[model samples]
Target: IPILMGLFAAGGTIYGMAEESLPFYTLLVPVMMAARFDPVVAAATVLLGAGIGTLGSTINPFATVIAANAAGIPFTDGILLRLAILAIGWLICVAYVMRYARKVRADQSQSIVYDQYESNKKHFLGDHDETQTLAFTTTRKVILGIFAAAFAVMIYGVSSLGWWMAEISAVFLGAAIIIGLIARMSEEEITTSFIDGARDLLGVALIIGIARGIVVIMDKGMITDTILNSAEGMVTGLSSFVFINVMYWLEVLLSFLVPSSSGLAVLTMPIMAPLADFANVGRELVVTAYQSASGVVNLVTPTSGVVMGGLAIARVPYVKWIKWVAPLLGILTIMIMVMLSVGVML
Candidate 1:
């Protein structure tokens, strides 16, 4: 499931697929709970899987393409390097999630959220009988097929057909109606079911909305511009090694304030990219460093709707998530810095 999440994220260039991942928390949380894992495991799998993939985005139009364009280079300039980082970073994330998952599965006491285990189980699993084996009815089989087809079409639409969030939402909404019809649900039942599902996600929706509001406030105050100017001044005359690393860390800090990858790309690349020449580094390395830092920071940045919203859906507390993911973040930061330094030398 984590691998599938990563693969989907690798193709999520249109809007970064942050909110797109929300629905999966409802789907995967119960399944992971049934398998004796906690909600944290499900949340980590989706968050880290997608987060790491976005961090190493090779062809993602939002991060790589936008940054490269702003840096006055072809998007493909450092494709091979990004692809390598994607692969290595994804492996590291998968192994980290699996280790925690295995520990939770083998002994529930090892789960980070063990105290909330019973409540989480009741909240996510509801009254479903764990001992009862559900037969694969034909209706269920068809519903599953439709569910899979909806995602397939979503990916195809986004990657090839220029579909944005509205189009993607339409596809899912249409699928939900069709599935409801196929199941012979009454009109009231379908509407009620939809409302119930939305209610369950109300907290997540508010978190996303509030996070966006914070971004709006920052933009209105021109704080983002001020920070960008400050970052530019800080890295003006450093050597290649120090310059790239400082740029990476600056981006890491900036991503918290401006979580939108494309927005950050447009804001910083032009200013920072030219500075790379003064430091005797290629502009492509600047794009690389920028995207890498953005990717790493977005993994846990609270200002990001994706991070806050995903945790809300998974019933994972923000602080607990930080505790669980801090080590993996440290490891990724080191790997990214090493890669950025090497790119400078090359």
Candidate 2:
């Protein structure tokens, strides 16, 4: 599931796949709970899987491409470096989540959310029948095939055909109808099921709206620009090594205020990219620092609709998520600092 999240996200340019990932929480939370893992595991799988991929974005237009362009470099200028970071970061994230998952599966008492285990199980698995074994009938198999194909087509369309949410939503809607037809469901059943599913995710939708509202408020107040201007002053006249690391941390702070990757890139890269020359580092390194910091912060930023919405859908508490992800966040932070320091010297 983490790998799938990475693949799906790595292909697209939609705010690090934060909104794109909300539906999967509804799908994966129940499965993870049934498999004796906590909702945190499911939430982390999607968030970090996609987060790390975006952090080390190579071809991601919003992150890597836009930052590179604003920095006056080709998007492919540091492609190999970004790919290496993505590969390493993905492995680290998968291992961290797997370790927690295995511990939770081995003993439910070990789950970080063990206190809410019963309630979470009930909330996520209430519709499921534990006693009834599902038959792998041909109809079921075909439905699964269509489900997989929907995602495959979505990925292809986004990567190659420039498809966005409208196009991708149409693909899923069409696939859902086909699946309903294959299952021989009546029109009323289809509509009811669709409405129920949407109702179930309504809270997540609202959280996303509220989060975006906050971004809009910040923009209207010019708070993001103020923060960016302040950051510009702090990085001037530092040594190359110190300069790159400080730039990364500054970007991290800005990512919270401006969670949109493309927005941040356009705002900061133009101002910060040329400063890299004074620091004696490549502008591409500035692009890398900016994107990597944004990627890392988005993993946990409350300002991000993706992070909050995914947790809401997974039924994971925000505080509990912070407790669970802090260690991994620290590790990634150190790794990124080291990578940026190395890039400075290189």
Candidate 3:
């Protein structure tokens, strides 16, 4: 009643939480605080005001619960760890954003840099709007039909041949042919698209490919038996926590092998939890590494279902996607590490 009465008193100045409230809040909070805070402080306060929703979205309870319990930690423990991590990681992320936002603005200021250079400028047929240049040709329809049929056949073929990846290649090959037909593509056009697709996937696919390496990197830190063993001959060995870093790195690397984040947790966390405790480390730490390592690298990897599906849907060449997101993947990886290291998280 008090809140409503106050809002009613303000009338037009007050607004309800509705579909478009987010941008409104972002723009309004600073204005409301104009009397009390300096401009910088007011803007920051407004930005921070929206923090809870962002945190909640990023730190999903379902993922936390799944990771925590599977790793033999309490669910509450997961929440606590997530909150801490969120604070630290997001602080670093935000600082990075603030730092880079200027660079982005600067880059956009000279937006025609690529076009300004003469040699590197590309005018390939399928580069931008292939849909306009390449009509649906007879060959394209046939190839598409063959590609569609391959889906059913590939499933059966996998059961028969015991090669899961054969299906993917078959589909890609069939699609290539279909695309060629529809575009009335010459052999060169067919080859060009295939090459283009492969080219685009370079970095993005590799990022997915390297998830396992990152996980393994953490797992193999100084705290591992191997480190302890090396230390046995030396002075004192490394801290046990260093071993946690090793495990985290190892998990990142192994993520390439597992591919699916939740699936990897199911397979690894059960084993990892006991291993961490046996090694005298915290299970929550391992879970943190596992989640972050899987997440950051997963965003860039081409082999992922989301990635491949997005490419297929967008008609983006794999190489192009790689070129587009490779650096972002690096930035995100650094962010994950920064989040994990600063005691911001569990």
Candidate 4:
């Protein structure tokens, strides 16, 4: 289940769910407790999995699409590079989580959140059955098939038809209805389930909204351009390679203030894209840097509602979460820096 959840969270990263970790965390926390593993393991599986996933987003509308469009480049221009980054990220995240899971499973005291895990077990694990495996029924198999088909349709629609988020969301809505029908849920049950799901995810929505508020404040203050202008002067006269690396780190810093990928694209890409031309760097490289850097920072930035809110749900203190995730984050950053250097050469 941890492995499956990690894969699922990785997919969520592709969709750019930096501030939306609660739903996955909710599903994982209980299972981890029931398995007698640490809650930190559950949190790490979802949080870091999604974090690394976002860093590797190839076709994410929020990150790649907006940044590409802002740079006046075709979104498909950086596909191969982004896919390579994603593949590397996915491998690292899976290995890290698996290694940590083994440690905690063998001895729960090694977990940073061991005390909290013990206290919370009663609340989260009372009804769970660690020994019982789910029996797959005909209806369950049909539901799984529909779920997989929905993803195929989404990929085809986005890659071939250029469908946007609205259309992708519609596909999910249609699939949800079909799944409900196949499960033999009554109309009332469907409605109730939908509400319950939404209610459970209310914190995620609130966090995203609050995070956006920071961007709103910066825009109104008229300091956003000042920061951009300042950044431009600092990068002037650097070699293309150095310039792109600086831009990557710049995006990492700016992402702290503006957690929204689309917002950052709209704010920085216009300025950074034109500047890239003067530095003898490709606009595609600029976009890649923005998406990659911002995605990495999202893992730990306080401005990101996703990180803070996810930690809140997992009962993880901000300091402890940092201590637990920092080593892996550093490794991921070094790997990305190498990839960006390669991208500059390309």
Best by the TM-score measure: 1
Model 2 misplaced regions, further than 4 Å: 1-16, 127-131
Q: Give Cα-based local distance difference scores for all models.
A: 0.85, 0.84, 0.45, 0.78
**Which consecutive 10 residues in model 1 have the weakest lDDT in total?**
8-17
Those runs of model 4 whose alpha carbons end farther than 4 Å from true positions after fitting are: 1-6, 9-14, 18-21, 127-212
lDDT of 4 by residue, 1-346 (tens): 3466456555654566543345557657886777767777778787777766677777777888888998999988878888788778778877877788888889888788877765678656666566787889988999989987887787667545867668887987899899999898999999898897677567666765787677788878977767877887888888988998898888887887777788888989888898888888889889989988887788888777777777767667889988877888788888888988898787
Give model 4's clash tally.
1
Candidates in descending lDDT order: 1, 2, 4, 3
140 in model 1: Cα distance from truth in Å? 1.3
The per-candidate count of clashes, in order, stands at: 0, 0, 50, 1
**Window of ten residues with lowest summed lDDT in model 4:** 12-21
Error of 3 at 20 (Å): 21
Please give the lDDT score at residue 39 for candidate 4. Answer: 73
Residue-wise C-alpha lDDT for candidate 3, range 1-346, written one tens digit per residue? 1222222112211111111111222233233222221222222222222221222123333244566778767745544555554455445434533443344244533222233222211311213332355568776677657655655564445434544454557655775676677667799888887787577556444554454454455456622335334422331233555655666667666565555555667766776666666556667766777766665444345445444433332233556545544564566556555655543233
lDDT digits (tens) for residues 129-170 of candidate 2: 777888899999999999989977876786678788899899
| Winning model by lDDT | 1
TM-score: the better of candidates 1 and 4:
1
TM-score, candidate 3, is 0.42
Please provide TM-scores, in order, for all candidate models, with all chains considered together.
Answer: 0.95, 0.93, 0.42, 0.77
Model with the higher TM-score, candidate 2 or 4:
2
lDDT of 1 by residue, 1-346 (tens): 5666576456543335566676778788998899888898888777877777778877778888899999999998987777778888888888888888898899999998899988897888889897798899999999999998998897788767888789998999999999999999999999999999889889888998998899999999998888887888899889999998999999988898999999999999989998999999989888888888898888888888888998998889999999989999899999989998888777
